[model samples]
Target: MIKHRLFWPTASLLALLLGNFIANPGFFAIELRDGHLYGSLIDILRNGAPLILIALGMTLVIATGGIDLSVGSVAAISAAIACLQISKLGDQNSISGMLGAMGIALALSLVLGAWNGLLVAVFGIQPIVATLILMVSGRGLAQLITEGQIITINSDPYKAIGAGFVVALPLAILIALTVFVLISLVVRKSALGLLLESVGGNPEASRLAGVQSRRLIWLTYLLCGLFAGLAGLMLSSNVSSADGNALGLWMELDAILAVVIGGTMLTGGRFSFGGTLIGALLIQTLTTTVYRLGIPPETTLLFKAVVVMAVCLAQSPAFRRKVLGRRKPKPPAQASQTQTKVEIPA
Candidate 1:
């Protein structure tokens, strides 16, 4: 099963975990506290929730032979909208106000998703350029919403979205897990997965075969925005503040990296949710390792770059052959009879 798509990502995740364990023995230790599990491993799940959610959405987008570079900006806008709503409310701490703010954020997310869909699916704009339009302008929209200021809120229920515990696990983790399961069911339980692969593998073929290619692609972008909004909510809730400028900066890149490392081809065709999940975890583990090992803050990026490059090479069949050398084919066997010594004429 070494050739299996999930195998390498899974192995990488385990290797990262093992490295963490070596650097800090407590990395794998989980303890009970207030009826909840607590540990570095749990922390990884908690902190990585936003990336996990975004990566799930990215997986779908990539599966349709498209990329959403605006996911990060969508996240910023989501946080801005939610935080702005709450800041203007009479009771910022009220659960009703928080819910209303969340609703507004999600509504705006749908609009943004539709906007991207319109540009790409309807207008026939290239996915990268279409998404780049929002990628640049969305942060400006977020800045406008917050009036070039960081919006902060003080609400326990709101904070609970990012920090609370449910069934002895982080709420963010639970939310991500629920989304993953639902999407997995929707995509894998039916022919949707095949249709998506067909479209990505060959849009013209899929279209000729009666697949509504535009609708499918549009829907993928919509879902990507939806999940980015959710991730924004989790991030703002965690900090109780929304920094339009800094929030979700470069998150799209991270999501893309996670998607690639998960064995989803950049060209798009097939994908693995399990691999994506492990890839997200691997990234978080790498970050944690950097800090645990006391690596210089300035060099962290370089270190991550090296590790990520190694992973990419490991996953590349051509790179593997180049580095490890290909095996030679076996020669044909000779007959056991007396004619074995016969040679071909020159």
Candidate 2:
């Protein structure tokens, strides 16, 4: 089952790489300059890392059959808050001020996460409706933080958070790896994974089993928000600007696509964090491939749509049975002359 679960995404990624290689032989090169990795592959990995982090959290939420549409907005808000704080520390401010801003941004993210939890767990509101409220308002709040202005900071420490490298690998990749490991440990080492799957598979059954389904759902969203906050910080750090409108624009879709492509069902139940990582990488690779091939950027969305449709169709049981059912063996026919032949022999 595990092998089968991984087959589609793996195959798709392999095919994509092969196609890109055919189009451009230079797609696989990795170069290091000035102690930093530089390559098309590295760029894809770096750019995709934030989405991988967000998708990691989304995997847990989707496992409980819930969606957090507010993640993109949460990211924007986090970035704005972080940038606003850093802006307070003039361009000449010391590293300590930058570090203080990061701390504040992280704290605010946790608070927002807790707010999401309270609404869904305590108020019992539908996940979609509850998250949507923030999805719309969160951006506004981010804009308000900057007073509708884009605050650009020229701090090296802040820039390093996004664009810096550690041991030749992008810092974003490291952050993504850390988050992946932490979340994996929490889910697999504890009862959380089983509880989440059970709730997603059948909420009523889980409730009867004494699982705190609502609390579980709420916590998942909170985690999603928290990750979104991290992603926002990474994004703003990369550009050194808090443009709320462009911070995490439409990233919720990408995160959802990563979750779905990772083999997590939209209805929820079982989820694969590793699969989400693969999915994020695949998406980034696709975009990079398109750009390298000189294809119009707008066409990338169409490609994404097609891939998503194909994955959804492949996962549908009805579609699989329909395609597989035709190959079943038919019963053999009885011979009509067998009795006559036996009688003659007798």
Lowest summed lDDT across 10 adjacent residues in model 2 is found at 337-346
List, residue by residue over 176-268, the lDDT tens digit for candidate 2. Answer: 999999999999899899999999999899999899887888788778878888998899989988898778888888899888888888898
Model 2 TM:
0.89
After superposition, which runs of candidate 2 have C-alpha atoms over 4 Å from their true positions?
Answer: 1-3, 91-93, 315-346
The lDDT values for all models are 0.90, 0.84
| lDDT digits (tens) for residues 226-249 of candidate 1 | 999999999999999999999999
**Residue ranges of candidate 1 with Cα displaced over 4 Å:** 328-346
lDDT, candidate 2, at 244: 81
158 Cα displacement, candidate 2 (Å): 1.0
* Model 2 CA RMSD to the hidden true structure, in angstroms: 5.2
- TM-scores, in order shown? 0.93, 0.89
Itemize residue pairs with steric clashes in candidate 2.
none
